[model samples]
Target: MDAVNLEEQAARQQLFTTLYQKVFPAVAKYVSKCGGSFDEAKDVFQDALISYYEKSHTADVTINSSEGAYIYGTARYLWIKRYKQGSQTKQLDDSSAYSIIAETEAAPSEDKLLHFLETAGKRCMELLRSFYYDNLPMTRVAQLFGFSGVRSATVQKYKCIEKVRDTVKQKALTYEDFLE
Candidate 1:
């Protein structure tokens, strides 16, 4: 009813639209790939989105990666949390269980990747971040990044990945640097 409330509502709508167009479907796919169903994926993504939004609203909240990357990371965290809470305590595969636990507890790597992307073109960095790091749906990402559709986004994402991969490879040319 109030002007401030209306503005906030509009902002919320914009956020939802941006997320719906940029976030959801990719996360759903990742969830499904990791042995979750569509319904489960939806639930997980919804919780992740809520957490992301809350974090976003906080002062000086700087996302070192694309919004998609942030969402994916959050979704993965929420999914792991849900799994821990669920009664499926029986181990399915021991190695997988270990890897999953390791990944879930690892520290964030956004800032490091972001610094790499910064030297790359802004558009390329955005595309790479959304697709590879964030795991956003190609369909929506294509539209957001000015591609024709999902197909283009997919191809572009592949190319961008290659670029990043190449960059990493080049940087790692010396084995001594990587040695502890």
Candidate 2:
């Protein structure tokens, strides 16, 4: 079984290497002409390759007839599907757009709330982290936090949530407050 798995992995690696060599330049050219960066082109090409491979494995995909064209078209379609979805027609080449995103994410109001949570609500935050962030089961959380059982842990979890909810309501957090 291990040998068979190794052989399959080798075949897949070879296929990927061959496809990237044979088809990537054209995909990169198309992406660049479309004003996308080299990294974005690589991402699109890799995703298209994986999609093509998966489709070929599952069905009678006739990608051999025009491998280059098929790969390029798939990559372009994926890029458009990913980046141009909804009514958003944002340009990928614009650095300013990304910087604006970074700025908004760094909003001062949310930071203040988070900092307050860190200080004032540290124990609740720790419990939430153990259960939710660390993905510990209620049983394990109860064990770690010295609760009697899962039910006790779960009740405490809800209590923490209600406390945070009340705090948020009391402070009247808004979208702008959440944003940087």
Candidate 3:
């Protein structure tokens, strides 16, 4: 019985691999067509892969739905999320109102800055997030994060901000020269 179950798992794995190989490029194309670059498409595709994994692991898991359909649906949802987040102007439409709450919580620049801060270092990320996103005072942040005092916290926060700024500048440079 164990051997049979193992064989079945292997078969399912192979099937999933085949489906991903067949569908990813198509989803990428769809993402690019919808105002996203290849990198963004790749990110969306990665998210969709996680979504697919979660769906596949469910107790009611069945292959009755086409894998392509599942992935495409997830990719579409991701792309829509990306679009709503990127757009500056708010125009309410009935269909999208349910998802708008999550999208409106942060500006895109703040999101990118947060992502950069996260990539910098855990300590820096925590310090910056505590100060900025959580709106904590320097003394409070220092006490919470074990910094020596408010001045030290202030300096650490400045350094973290500089690191985040540098990361953003570097990323922006890849697209266009910031000085020009």
Residue pairs whose backbone atoms clash in candidate 3: none
- Candidate 1 Cα misplacement greater than 4 A, ranges: 87-180
How far out, in Å, is residue 28 in model 3? 1.2
lDDT of 2: 0.82
Global lDDT for candidate 3? 0.79
Let me know the TM-score candidate 3 reaches against the reference structure.
Answer: 0.40
Least accurate 10 contiguous residues by lDDT in model 3: 171-180
Per-candidate TM-scores read: 0.46, 0.45, 0.40
RMSD over all Cα atoms, model 1: 17.4
Error of 3 at 122 (Å): 65
TM-score of 2: 0.45
lDDT of 3 by residue, 1-180 (tens): 699999988987887688668888998889888878988887887788778877887989765677788887888898898888888566779868866775565335645445666866899988887887899988899999888889888988888788877887777644222212
Candidate 3 stretches with Cα past 4 Å from truth are 1-16, 60-64, 89-180
RMSD of candidate 3 to the true fold? 17.8
Of the two candidates 2 and 3, the one with more favorable TM-score, higher being better, is 2
How close to the true structure is residue 156 of candidate 3, measured as C-alpha lDDT? 85
Better of 2 and 3 by lDDT: 2
What do the candidate models score in CA lDDT, each in turn? 0.79, 0.82, 0.79
